[model samples]
Target: MAAVRAGWRRGRIELRQSFTNRPELFSHFLWPVLMLVALFFLRHRDFGSTGLLLGTFALPGILGMNAAMGMVSMSQQLTADREDGTLLRAKATPNGMLGYLVGKVVSVAGGLLADLAILLIPALLIVDNLALGSFGGWFTLLWVLALGMVATLPIGAVLGSVFTTARSQGLLQLPVLGLIAISGVFYPITALPDWLEWIGQVFPIYWMGLGMRSALLPDSTVVVEIGDSWRHLETVGVLGVWAVAGLLVAPVVLRRMARRESGSKVAERRERALRRVA
Candidate 1:
């Protein structure tokens, strides 16, 4: 109980900073919202609110698009902590690592809530006809978002732990972009070639988008011709595998990164910056 309470408090503190101070909650989502609006105007004829075809993808696209920012932010924040010796300082303190992790998860959970609201509120207000009427679907989407968050968060931590440089961060952005493009988030997977669809199936984006659409829209609006909608065992299985894989690999990667770091190496990087500034 004590640990849970302390963790709750720490998470709230982190969430407060995430919203008001750093505003990670807002920064990562602003552009995607704009893109959604821009596309809406560009295709009003298609983005209607009736039939199995109606609103088939509004929720999925928005949610699927967000996967990139979540993973990127996770990687960058972890790297930032390591770069500034925050991770090492936590390593030295009792229960620091546990507290730090709890705070991060809480922050992510809170941020996603805010993020989904950013989509949902505007959607309900601006688009009159497309409001979600099904309570069952809403519950399912919440679970999908939760699963997606869990599945992706560990991967972010691993990337941050493995790569010490911001350059590596920049390089890895390509895969993130590519995944979203092919993941059937913005469009129907059937629209793509068979091989491309298969590639998308091999990723979390496909499942996340599938599960989200099931939750946020009517049964008639579901786009997937296949997949278990309610239970989502395959989607759940994939996410579970990724999360487990990340947990197994993260500690090893972090340890390796730690070994490569020396007092002088850190000093050298800092000194180079100082020299450049001078």
Candidate 2:
């Protein structure tokens, strides 16, 4: 209980810091601005014979991709905190690692939702034929967003634990970019080759995007989806399995990583970083 309270407070402070920090503020807005520009160009383009504008079809998928990217932010933050001695300090206190991790989840999740609002509000104004007005639509959107977060964030923690350094964390970007390309964030998966479609389905990003599309897009737009239907059951199943796998794996990995943190290790890292800068 004390740990939770401390974690909540820590998360609030970090979230506030992100808004006040100039570099952080710029990064927060950068992705959303890029997405809006892409949607602007796609606004008039139609998708096949479905009569759906490409931008409208693409918006929900973008939201899902944004939600999934929260994992990357979380992973990167963990690496930063570790390098800066934050994790070392956490280890020195009772139940502090627990507090630290809880705080991280709160901060990352909160930031991601804020970014989503920044994109979504402007998007709703510009995009047409969205189904946001209906109660069922909103419900579906909410659950899919929630589940997508659950499915990705812990896997990100595992990645952070494994990589152990910011440079190594940067290496993860290429694979993530490749996955996004195949996941159909900017286009339809059905248009891809069969083998590529199979590879995309194995990852959580595709299902997250598909789930978001099902919620926001008109029913007629399902024609572009594989099997000519929105695979809600498959979305739940795949994300659920991922959520379970991540939950099982993350704790052990995080606990092991946390156990290895020390003041000396952090100081050594800081010196190495300074040497590189010099």
- Number of clashes in every candidate structure? 1, 0
Cα displacement (angstroms), candidate 2, residue 40, comes to 2.5
**Backbone clashes counted, model 2:** 0
Screening candidate 2 with a backbone cut-off below 3 angstroms (N, C-alpha, C), the clashing residue pairs are none
Query: For residue 24, what is the lDDT in candidate 2?
Result: 90
Which ranges of candidate 2 are over 4 A from the true structure?
A: none
After TM-score superposition, the amount by which residue 120's alpha carbon in candidate 2 deviates from its true location, in angstroms, is: 0.5
Model 1, total clashes: 1
Scanning candidate 1 in windows of ten residues, the lowest lDDT window is 47-56
lDDT of 2: 0.86
Candidate 2, residues 38-123: lDDT per residue as tens digits?
Answer: 98898889877778888998898789878878888888988888888888888788888778877887888889988998998899
- Please name the candidate that would achieve the greatest TM-score relative to the true structure: 2
Q: TM-score, each model?
A: 0.82, 0.93
Cα-based lDDT for every prediction: 0.67, 0.86
